[model samples]
Target: MPADPEPTAAAAANAAESDGAFASPTPELWQALGWAPDDNQRAQFLALQQQLREWNGRLNLTRLVEEADFWIAQVVDSLWPLLPLLRERPEAPLRCIDVGTGGGFPGLAVAIALPNARLTLVDSVGRKTQAVQAMAEALGLAERVELRCERVELTGRQKRCRGQFDLALARAVAAAPVVAEYLVPLLASGGEALLYRGQWSDDDQAELDRALALLKARVSRREQRELPAGRGLRTALTLQPVAPCPAQYPRAVGVPAKLPLGA
Candidate 1:
């Protein structure tokens, strides 16, 4: 018989916790996604979870707060894009944005998951942005993590923010076309957007394609997966910018949602 494989980071952490002051690591969580968080990363992740739970009262932050749901929806879903990005472009440093980051699902989670990936979490809601800002500072990520309380359209208009991101993400935010509209603008040339959806449709695809063309982006890849423990179905559509988004893009606040370019 073959010898046993070495222990996973979580397994090692658990072993250490029983032996010394090592804290429990959410190994199984990252393991499901083929990534492992070290002791320090795990500590930060745990702290982020606690803060999310505590702020849930006013922020109404996450619907996936139950233990299993939290791990699958918030943790795994947030970092799923990172693995693909790292695998595809191993050497690129990340400058990311989470559009319409209500309660900072993937934005805040991504900051904790990939500490080196600088993140800007954008939300139109003041309360949500304020809460995330406080949490970022409390977690000692104030410098690397920024919270913007404004419409996504406005951010795209600002010279300082536009075209500065390597990656952009929006989860459960809006229809695909609208999301592409909001994201494609903030991305640097060659940047990519990850649109997380619960369902995919031809109509959605057509609309997104039409919308992205206007914005100089295109859907380059799509992945579908069902979360573990019957959490439910999910998909991530990756859009690559062929060129820069026209200055006209992102339109105005409420336009993308109401008129919905492609759709």
Candidate 2:
């Protein structure tokens, strides 16, 4: 079980001066997730959060402008979704690729949490990839991560990325239908695609439905929870790719957003 939050004034001030007491969840944020790091791990995580904040200003890597919030929202929040998978497969090392990994939400956090896991952060933009690469290196996580500056769709279509990863992750990167096309080809058979989403509504469900049909995916799970302190609703949709994706997928970049397959 997780312990209570650290009640130091600095902790509170860090949380308060930002947008919320929990703007970004730190080690304190882990309590809400039902887990807590040991003192050593907590300190390491705090230092990493601070480093990310310092670099964020110069590189514009993220909009999580507050230091404390960086610990909570970006790091802890991203870590929450991975716990279930980790618990289920404790012995197996997870091999994951984050598609369109801008500022490394979920990807870097995952790397930090699961040191044993292998992560590949992929993006089409060179500058963004450079930022991720630099941050990972600064955090001393360079050896465990692979930084690839390439278009995910093109990469997926190629013979190489096919069935490469055990898991594929995307956070608010694209619509569910579109993301399915981009993810299916990259996932190994039976690999899972997890999407970090904001708010669950009929429209979102509709979009997911389209993607599931087109890609022959099955909804493995949907973890719904309110963001910390009533910020808003957030959902993590996990889909299992049961079959190979069609060749016409990903629809050239703007195509998916403009005219979604099931739209």
Candidate 3:
């Protein structure tokens, strides 16, 4: 079994004391989630926030640099989708990949929650991946986190990328179908892809349907919640790959987004 995640008391304390878009979740939010970081994990989260701010000035990794915004938009948003997996308490270590990991949002944050879960972060931007690579190294997470500065389409089509993950994650990146094209190729058969979005509409579902038909994946679950600090709405669509993706999928690099399935 993977080792238990220890808490970071000092950082957790600071998290509890602050209030802002970047402030840690309020007491109520904590209660609702029924999960809280231990002393060590809280320290990791603290370190992540600091790195995000420091790198933002140089790499412009994200606009959500303020503490409160960072927590709500990047940290918490990344962790929430893993709630189901955490609840299961699986004994086996997991494999997870984050596509289009701009500055390593859900990928790095999720790594903190599931320390044993191998994390591969894929992004096309060299500087962004460099920033995340440096930040992960600084946090001493280099052992667990893998960085790739490549387009998802190219990575997804590679032999090394196929059927490698228990979970594939993409956030604030693309519409549902487009996300499926980018995510499904990396997931193991029966594994899941979690697509993060701000809103879910009937049209979006319809669009997703067309894409799923092509991907041989299906919507397994959909979750919606108000973000902490009332920043905005958040939607997570969980899709399970029922079959192997067609080889041509993920298409040539830059193709999926431009021609987006179901478009």
Candidate 4:
């Protein structure tokens, strides 16, 4: 990917102003997640917000640009699901993959917070991947982050990628069943797939159960929490593969989302 241009004076000033505007959320997020970002990590989060703002105009990366919305909806929402893992193995050299990592949300946030995690962020759009790569480099996380510009279905099937990650994550990617199909095949033994959703229902659980049966996975944990300031309800579902996912999993590049496993 090409390098991003050096920030002009106005851009630098804008970023600094943006940083100040969003600065107050750091403590709020720390309290909400029960996890604190060190000085460097906090800086990285600010940089991420700046990058999102800079790129959104050209790439339409995300809609959550306001300070509170970005902090609560993107940063907090991404990291909230990983609290248990963060607490259990804060320094582990975790191998993680973020499927459909548009604008590199939880993936970038995860990399910053964990410090030791190696993240493979996959997205089908070349422009989005390139933007994320630039953002990762700007944050000094490029060394530990890998960007793949391809469909996640293909990534899950590749020998080097399949069954290789300690954690697989998909947020608002698709229906529960489709997200399960996209994530479960990429996990190593004992690895977990964390699905981030909003307003999950009993019908959603039923569909996910049927999908897991086909994927040879089981829900190991489920947690629902209200986003701070009443943004909305969020659900995090962790699925563990009970057996090797059949080689046929993930269907095809567009099939999982179109047909949706167990539909």
Candidate 5:
């Protein structure tokens, strides 16, 4: 991946003038994470917002186009769960896949923050993938990002993608068990899967445990953080492969979502 572009005069002005909810987070949030965006990263984030706004009218990519909403719900929400890895090895050359990456939330935001990481953004919808591809190129991230407009189940079955990524992420994609099936098959041994959920309950964990048993994986960590401004609680569950996932996993194109593991 290439180095981030230098912040232009216009970008600096925009960042400096922004106020209220539109403004970047106070230093405390980023400080707690042990990472902060430099001028170049800030510029890339602004560019990403602009791209989402421009395409959203036609693509209906996301409703959170307002500056404040985008910053909190999209940008911050995406990066917060990554605190551990970002603080531990900020420059690791990680291979990551975002399954069902509608409008490329965490995937595109991640590419901006982690310059050394390569990303594969997958969504079943072709239009969404195409829009995300354009956004990646506009942000000068095309070189490091690959777009796959196919169902994640198929992606997990493909030789080039199966057991290929150091990290797999899925946010608001499906039920925990279904998501486990989708993500576990794509992780290389020793790799981790992060599931971003809005609300996690004991019932959810129990179902996921049953699913992981079939996948030869186990939950490695679970953490929850309250989004700023009371947007709600967010839970991130990390799963590590105990053994190779069975080949039958990820079932058929719609099976995981329809029937789900542990169902």
Candidate 6:
């Protein structure tokens, strides 16, 4: 009989706490993501997680506090859907903006996995941005990243960031239609936006469908996969802008959250 295959990094990490070495989040998970961090990177990741845990006790930064969840759900899972983009632009210097990056999902993990890419993490809440800044520093990524504490709709007028990013990413921030309105304008022409949706179904496609017609955006790829958490499925809805958004989109503060476009 054929021997069993080696366990994947995710499988190994979730093996069992009793297994010691293979259990919990480890550098091996990063290695599996094709980002075989050196000693420094390994240390940085560990330090960031510890600090996040510390801060979470006070601020409730994230619901994922366990080590295994941090590694698989936050780190490994976030980067999995983004591998296609990284591969296509392996040598290209790209700028990515993660909007409403609460506790920094794809933003922080993407920065760690793709050191060459410049990341701008934006959140309106001061405390969230503060945590993001601290996390970036803890990971020794201060130089490679930028943090913004501002509303997404108000950011369009800023010369430094207006239409500056090559890609935009958001997770569970808002409905796809609203998120498209918020992020598509930030992307350079021909660039793409990635929206993460958890409760995706034939019904959920309504949001994407509405955005495409109204926001001059089109879905390039709809990737669906189960998160390492095993509790829910994630859909990476990739949207490309075919034309500039009407100036009226994104409305004003609290508007997008209250009433998504095409709703």
Quote each prediction's TM-score. 0.85, 0.84, 0.88, 0.89, 0.89, 0.84
Per-candidate Cα lDDT values, in order, are 0.76, 0.73, 0.80, 0.86, 0.85, 0.74
> For residue 27, what is the lDDT in candidate 5?
68
Query: What does candidate 1's lDDT look like per residue over 71-149, in tens digits?
Result: 6667777777667654454445589899888767888777766667888898988988988898888788898898888
lDDT of 4 by residue, 194-220 (tens): 999887667888999999999999999
The regions of model 1 sitting more than 4 angstroms off are 1-26, 86-92
* Clash totals in order: 0, 7, 13, 0, 0, 0
Predicted structure with the largest lDDT when compared to the true one: 4
Query: Which candidate, 4 or 5, would have the higher lDDT against the true structure?
Result: 4
Sort by lDDT, top down from the best = 4, 5, 3, 1, 6, 2
Candidate 5 C-alpha lDDT tens digits along 1-263:
12223445655555444434434545644553346888888789888988998999898999987755787788888999898777788789999999989999899999988989999999989999999999999999999999999988899999999999999999898889999999999998789999999777778889999999999999988877756544556888899999999989979888888897887
Write down the worst ten-residue block by lDDT for model 1.
16-25
Which residue pairs of candidate 1 clash?
none
Query: What is the alpha-carbon lDDT of model 3 when measured against the actual structure?
Result: 0.80
Output the TM-score of candidate 3.
0.88
Better of 2 and 4 by lDDT: 4
Judge candidate 1 at residue 172 and give its lDDT: 86
- lDDT by residue for model 3 (1-263), tens: 12223335654555445445235645554554456776777788888888988999897888886656776777777777778676676334788899989988888888888867889999999999999999999888999999999888888877888878888999988777888999888888778899998867778889998999898888988877655544556778899988888888988877887898878
